[model samples]
Target: MALKRSSSMKTQLVNGIQLQEFEQEEEINTSSSNNTPSEPAEAKAHTEPKYYTVEEAVETIGFGRFHVLLFVIMGSANIVEAMEIMLLAVVSPEIRCEWRLEDWQVALVSTMVFLGFMVFGVLCGYVADKYGRWKVVFGGFIWASYFSLLTSFSPSYGWFIFLRCMVGCGVAATSQGFILKTEFIPAKHRAFLLPLASIFWMLGSMLIIVLGMTVVPSMGWRWMIRFSIIPSIILIGLFLFIPESARFQVSAGNIKGAMSTLDWIARMNGVPLPEGELREPEVTERGNAFTLISPAYRRTSFLLWYTWFVASFIYYGSVLSSSELLEKNLLCVTDADAEHQIKHNHEEALCYCIPFNMADYQTLLISCLGEVALIPLNIALLNVFGRKASMAILLVLCAIFFMLVNICTTMFGFTVLLFLLRSVVSMNFNVVYIYTAEVYPTSVRSIGMGFCTSFSRVGGMIAPFIAQVLMSRSVIWAMSPFAAACVICAIGVVFMPIETRGRALLQHG
Candidate 1:
């Protein structure tokens, strides 16, 4: 009876196990049937759509409205700075006559101004980093404007030189404005628009020439210098509308400030705010000024400094010498009093020694027409060829033209070539501003650019002296060295890497 009962229990256990296995198999089949079609459908749904945050959308819109507005304001400031720079070149003759200055003495004014720039440019850069870019820019405008206004009151050559040095100190602040622009402008537009920002420079150059021809001779050079103050006032007034750079704020670890500024930019741009982590702290430490010389940046530092020195040497040398060159070249055809008259009223002078009269509408028309034609070319080449290539080509072309100027005898030939060379060289000047802004890391970029620019001012300071001495012998011959310098610059440019181009300011290694 016990054996029969045990057998019955085992049979019941086996039946229960078989029933559980059958239920599990049925559920697995049902799950597989449901998943087979839905897998592809679910993936397809994921592929069909995506979303972006407000910040991503805003950044996609490129530069915000505020950024563009600030660029315009800063660009105007640069124009004013450029006008002051061109003023001495355009009116050197009048200033020399008024002050009874020797060639070296006349050159001292430019040199002193540049000396101030060299000393203060570095200082301003450090200040910008420590305090703020806007502060530096505003200070520069105030400083330069005050000095430029005071320049009109100078009683002697020494007094003027002292005042001009102050002006240089003020103008050194222009680099801060430039850095702010680069920091705010979007990457896609940088390569093209960065150079375009220099349109104000060209405008300033043209303004000085136009004003010199129209106003300076009539009102005297003092009034001409005074006229430069107006632009600074306009720039300062416009500054109220511009904001500090978001990137700069982020780099300084003011994340909250950065976000606030970015939100403002977005609202101005009519776009939503983005969602992302703010920029992290710079891996490299800051505070020590000498860190610019670290191993990673040493080569860049040397190359940029040398390049700035050489480029400034050539650029300022040519510009400072313009008035002296024009004076000497005109002297070949007329006497002192007659040349002065010709400068004052070229329309009335017939068969005068100078090839073209500053006052003559035809000459002005021709010069401006040449510039207009070159603008499109500059705009096209700068973007297509990139900064390095365009700069290299322009330098070589300028060198060749400078050499050709020595050989060309026909007035028409000289006029055409000279005008073209001026146009081309002016275009290259824009390249330096863009390149300087692009090459350095954000932390030291302003200082690097400012230092080089200040050194370039040194070149500017020496230019008049060199030109005066060279012109004291032969005007054409003095320019030959400029051609050689250009050749050297072309070679030096070879070491520069292809620029950031349209890319944003890059991080240092």
Candidate 2:
């Protein structure tokens, strides 16, 4: 009986072990059914939400091929605008002969134009921020075009000055064009593209030379003023086809419009909509003029304004003085008969001008070529070197070159040094625009840029008078003041913060 009981216990123990094994298997299956395949905790922790790719972001922001084309077209318009600003410089001799005016009177034409730029630049920024960029830009085009046409028909010097000032008021649209370009371009492309836009100004300078040497001399000074109207009309028509900035739309609380524009861009570029919703930029309660003076931006405003003044003082002073400088230099090289004839007859004046042959063209071309030559240097040095460093280097170099040109006696030495100085100075012109735009928050960017440009205009206005004073004595004497201006620019550059290049626009105080 004991053996039979032991055997029964053994059998029961085996059955219990089997039952335990089965229960373990069932529990494992149930857990497997309830739980997902375990992702490593580290992997889960590191996972990030995908944002749009660069191409996708560009499309989402409405920067497509069509937009690029529009940028080029508008850039050409900028070239035209610059041409108009320098127009008086080219024809100053003729205007002086016709009006029987003093050097100050010739200077007044630029002053009036810049004064209009100063007053209306702020107004345009306000309109651009509050209303829309297109309206201000279009209005400027129409206004400037009509007045430019009127400038061609002025019968008296007073009428001519009044019309030129009116043209200045109309040309306030140039600021709007810059505002649009800044708003439309993506952040990555902003710095490089913005500086490249200055190439248009150089192109405009070239156009002025072309017109002065060709059209104005062949036709009359009035025809040169008339030619200015063509660019305005063409640009106004092209602007009608370009859409308003999507960024501006978003800023103004028009998300639907912004999205629709984005959709078009996406379709155009064959890209998908980015995943996130668009966030509107904060709208400040500050008025346009007051915004520039607000405590948060006051220091920035002061610095940039002063820089503008200095830059304009140097740049416009140099540019306006160019015709006089060239004429004087030519006089040094030419005979008495040629000089006398050039002083009297408009056609003969330009045609038989000193540096009369390919030499003048070569000189102008070399100056312009100096601008193009700096592009690579900018690309290489601008990123690796900070804004302040690059600006300081350029400014110091410009000052050195200016001083060298002032003291040098040989024509070859003067031309080479002058070209180098201009090249260096031109780089600053491009850099300043990029710096001003980058430093300000988007909410007040246009205002900041407009103010900077306005101060630049003030410098331009003051330039002719300063040059007239200096040049009335000797070419060397005129350049002495410019050398001083260069030193001031160099000092300003040294004090500026080094945070502008490749930086996102800061929104906080």
Candidate 3:
């Protein structure tokens, strides 16, 4: 009986142990079944990268040392360009004297440069948009520098026109820097920084004025042309230091290169990269001159183009006209006998060879200072009134000032009017520049600028006809059209559909 009871106990214990083992196996299987479906998803959630846009990345990086460095490097291009354009004003008379040319012929030298600028403007912008801004920019530096150096040794009037026209072609490439800068800069900082860029332009303008005062009188215009190459050479050597536009890189679908640039900007700015990969647009709009005038951008394009035309017409008109106005005021004495002598030998009496005296440089320098001084005003106007209103207001003011120039009787009064016109016109230029850059998408920004600027060159081409040619006949004739154009531009600006006051730059149309 005891043996049977012990056997029964052993059987029960084995049954319990078997039961526990089966339950444990069932639990394990259940857990595996539940987790198996979710494993890939969890892993993906943990390991997948975040995506960022160009503006987002730039916003995270913030404005810092990188931007400051960019401004100096890119702004140097502005200085060189300004000097080149201003050189035309300074040396036109010198070339006229050397070539024994008439006022109209002297005007052609200025006209030819704009012709080159206009002809190549769209092509360079297209190349920049399609290929890259950096290539067009630095390549242009080399091209412009080569042609400019050759221009110094120009043997005759024909060669001089051809070389300088090529120089304009090269100079046309330099405007890409502004587009490059617009791409990189955060929207919040554009108003202050962009208008501030005019400082470099003002510096170049004044620098050439100083050089014109010191160099041209002694060393001649050829030496002045030679001196202009120095900036290009320096920028070319520093080209490696300046990175290509990362915004441009992304738009071009160069994800790897764009990432590399962002890394550099992040490292240079001393910031961490925002989590995630840089996002590229699925379909990039390869921009051309046709894209610029497409139905979507057609209205804005036409208005902007016309604005650029008149703004340039009036700006260069004001610049070129200032020389004529100042020459008349300074050289033509107020004394009746002296005035009579001037009128009698007006062609011979005007100092074409050395038109600007020391006083003229001082006055010109002061007027240029107005561009820098009113920068704060431009910023405020841009921020407060927005682009369209500021442009219209400034344009109207510019016209009034242009008309006012006709009434000035004294040199001081004339200088003051010149200062007002320059300052207001410069403000208009800054507004239009910022407005155009903001309105266009990344794909078409450079091309759009090139197109609009080409029209500006058209105005530039015609400006000499008025400023140099018409001013020779009558100041009233010269000044009236400038005022009228300003009025026309103000009306057109008011009708502009887009006011890019605080807008993000679009990546594609």
lDDT of each: 0.69, 0.69, 0.84
TM-score of 3: 0.90
Ranking of predictions according to TM-score: 3, 2, 1
Q: Residues 66-136, candidate 1, lDDT per residue (tens digit)?
A: 76787788889878877877776765666666766666776777788888888988888877776678889
The window of 10 residues in a row where model 3 has the poorest summed lDDT is 336-345
Better of 2 and 3 by lDDT: 3
Residue runs of model 2 more than 4 Å from their true location after superposition: 1-64, 281-295, 330-362, 506-509
Q: List the residue pairs that clash in candidate 2.
A: none
TM-score of each: 0.80, 0.81, 0.90
Pick the TM-score winner. 3
Error at 33, model 2, angstroms: 14
Which lDDT value does model 2 have at 364?
A: 63
RMSD of each: 7.4, 5.9, 3.2
Candidate 2 at 278: error in angstroms?
A: 1.8
Itemize residue pairs with steric clashes in candidate 1.
54-273, 55-273, 55-274, 333-353
lDDT of each residue in 1-509, candidate 3, tens digit only:
99999999999999999999999999999998999989989999999888989888888888889999888888888888888888888887678778766678777888888999998888888898888898999888899899999999999989998898999999898888789888888889998899988889898899888888888889988988888789889988876678888888888889899899989999999998889888877436666567777888888999999999998898888888887655555223333233323431245554455366677778788888777778889999999999999999999999898887767355666677778888999899999999999999888888898898899999999999898878867777788999999898899988888888888888888
RMSD of candidate 1 to the truth, in angstroms, is 7.4
